[model samples]
Target: MTPSDDDRTHGGLETVTGAGCDGRDACCRLAAGVDRRRFVQGLAAGAGLLAWRAPRATVAGPFAADDAIDHFVPADKKLAADWVAGLFARGERTWYAGDDLATIGMPVGGVAAGQVYLTGDGRLVYWDVFNSNHNTGYGAVNYQAGRKPTDVVSEGTFTAATAVDQGAAIQVTVHGRTVARTLDGRGFARVRFCGEYPVGRVEYADDALPVAVALEAYSPFIPLCAADSSLPATVLKYTLKNGGDAAAQVTIGAWLQNAVLNDAGPELAGQAERRNRVVQEDRFTAVVGSARPLETAQEKRREPIVIADFEGDGYGQWRVEGEAFGDGPVEGTLEHQQAVSGYQGRRLVNSFQGGDDPQGKLVSPEFVIERPWIGFLIGGGGFADKTCVNLVIDGKPVRTATGKNAELLEVRNWDVAELAGKRARIEIVDAQSGPWGHVNVDQIELRDDPKTDAAIPLRRRRDFGTMAVAVLGGDASAAASIPDGDALEELFAALRGEPVASAEKPLGENLRGAVGRTIELQPGAEATVTFVVAWHMPHNYRENRWVGNYYGKRLASAVDVAAYVAKNFDRLDAETYAWLETYYDS
Candidate 1:
């Protein structure tokens, strides 16, 4: 059947085009276990939910009658096979919450929340925040770069201030903290301030012409990749071959599953084309092609797999963009041997947006959400020396493994948001320097632990969570009481780089020693690194407290050192790891 004009989109689950339901009530029409009475109650007003969209259900899961899957068709296997498949299909709207959304209603789920509906063409999805697919965040975050560009304020003064959309507040950041700075008039506003955070600019509508204050964050157009303080200057390589007789060239770029669920955009009602603001912040494209024909059959069968061109057909179809510094411009050769290289830029601006151009705001890693289980995959692929995957639960650090060393970033079958808490930290320690990217997984099959339904609980916040790293060239500590291994040692060197205060007598000395021996921090012109917590929304005090207990063990020292650190740290009243953001701790 053809997709209707009002069908919701995403997975095969769209709205109910079969009479009675008028495409408008997309939520209440889902085939899932939606309560009919409450469905009507929830559809009281016309909520413009078209503008935003985001995550979950990459592939399909098991089809239990209770699952209430609607309008989903698996070409090769069930939806569960595709890690990023849709849970609720057409008329199967109700789904669980994404990492960003917080828990919606009190005491949700339990077959009584309200009926949710899915759109018709494997598109549009809706669900009760508290219902079966629970947990939710305030709203999806997106690049709001329209009138102006992504900005990062620096530490200097500007001759004048540029006018953005009237009364619109601009996002500003300092160190790692974020805030808002609004324009008073429609034209140039005066200025004499300094600090870095709100970079990016458009032509200032003024006489003095906003030369974009100093450290006042210049780079007029920081790409989205340049905004998130986490992007590292590492190149990823993939290998895709011709699996079919048809000869073809592939255009590749880092794509994101834009999570901002703003029902405000005009494209809200499932459209063949997405016209809303995806903001293409840091969009670079590469083309991969092949001369030899790829025959279809069992040998080359990779399901929903995205590979780089081989023959140099696997590596050829991949696209290459960016000046990429040292290598000048890598058109199509991804040498797994010479992979993990250090950043060659200024390396001091804590975040990506704090730079000159090619800002991080636009350079998001290429992300794809598969069904069955969502794995956070980043960078190129390697078997022995590749990317690192870190896991943080509650406020504690979890262990990472690969059985044998590999050059690929992976987290097998993660069921949770792959430990994407509001406060989880992941670091890449590049010692062996082959390829050291990282990935985040949301679902995982039990490889060792048979505990089928392993749930990472959500509570409040606290000294919050501890930080940890999954080094590409090393291993983690066997036990907190013992020192880290050699693998972790080199890893720390890459992480610590040079001393913070000074190499001669670095400020966080003892702490650095403990961590450095754990993983090395490389020095010189490299990517300026900063610690990051993945958590976004907040739980209640109790929930937050549970999260803190889960990850903070790494923060504690051993024996004598522990005592000294403890005494001094106690002076801060245990608020070490911060749980900032209005969504949480409020």
Candidate 2:
């Protein structure tokens, strides 16, 4: 009789002579039904020392199904063979499509890159693979009432009904109607998912659409092939068969998010340093996502000319309004405020006089711009134009910048080369009256060159490595879309057959966005579209220590990993299929 699905067994043998197990005692235990002397002699004659077989149903224990209490069964309880076989003959288990059980999908990423799950309905979800936390649950921490930790440790799960439109997705346009292969919105009527470790298949069927689509997602897992098995990539192969009679224009699109530095923090909301660009190297075409550090120059030039030192005992030439700024430039930090730094001298503008309830604006005497750059130290709330320093020229603010919710001031430089010799004024406005509704300023200067030691914010760091998604063996045109609100909604517009105006220039930067690739097929034809997702997060953090990943030693970036997978797709695909065939035959 053939072995059932749960009847597979694995065994191995190793030398255990040093563990106080001489050949005599082990042989006697194995030779219970045979002669002890013959068994010991056979061991010396190069016979197998250890062997194991699948457990027989005669020795199986009882199966329990109770919800209120524990279902633990004793080891000595015996069940009949027919009863055990009947459990296997019931049917194959499957996870249905819904928002409640959406997190129970199959993992499709590499070993240490974290988890990226492909749900049963073909939508990619649960993207916790990035270094920052995403979906890992939370636990209680014991702490004093006023000493609670304020740092974010987790981002919680994304399995709600509203999150169904988030992450990567596939859309197929048949004739003029578009159908997202997910269980959300106007989804397919029937969906089936079957997952064997390292290989998963999702089949989609609907009466409204005239095509049948099946997706096979996996990472290479060939036995004894450690190098090929440990790749930091997942291959998504889509097979589509058109069942329509007449010729039909079928458009298939795959979209992915620029999830690098995901969950970093809320401070990175509108930074332009987050980028997604399309690249073509050799035969591989991919869209790489990364967070780049803000550019800085290290050159030394002329010394800065002081604009406003704010060192006098009172407001001499600068005019102050409202109750925010006191009668004069106050000293250091105010009452009920954090210790402030990075300012020169003993006097500076401190707007938190009474509290955050005060609002005011300080206007500087109009001065002709002689230098090419205007530099200043600023700190306070990040309310954009509400709590910021402005460079006003011709009665209009030409440049504006705000603090990053910080107490320590950082140098901010503005390139005012175009405004040189133009009459300009400095405005320190604190028109907000809410939490952190104050502003701080000091040591304003006009310089020939920009400041080189301006501290780069944490959200703009280049710590996050690159991640890429490539369409293997195809020169399909790709586009990157920056979202005004929802990233998936912007991506779906392209999948719904909308013309992308930026398709020719596939390079753009945004905090959150999507990249898409499109291709068309005729009716009654069969086609396979393959996509590979790869990442190169080299650094690993644990126990307050930083280390390097082994995969990073060979692959420098995600584009490199994708290119390697594209070059070896034939060999790796063949070996993976071969292993699966051998296992099913056994």
User: Residue 124, candidate 2: how far off, in angstroms?
Assistant: 2.6
Instruction: For residues 347-424, write the lDDT of model 1, one tens digit per residue.
Output: 110111111122111011233322222222222322222223333444343533221122222223233334332343
Tell me the lDDT of model 1 at 69.
55
Against the true structure, what is each candidate's TM-score?
0.16, 0.52
In angstroms, what RMSD does candidate 1 have relative to the true structure?
32.2
**lDDT value for model 2:** 0.62
Q: Worst 10-residue stretch by lDDT in candidate 2? A: 2-11
Q: Distance from true position, residue 148, model 1, in Å?
A: 18
- Encode model 2's per-residue lDDT on 354-382: one tens digit a residue: 88889999999999999887888888876
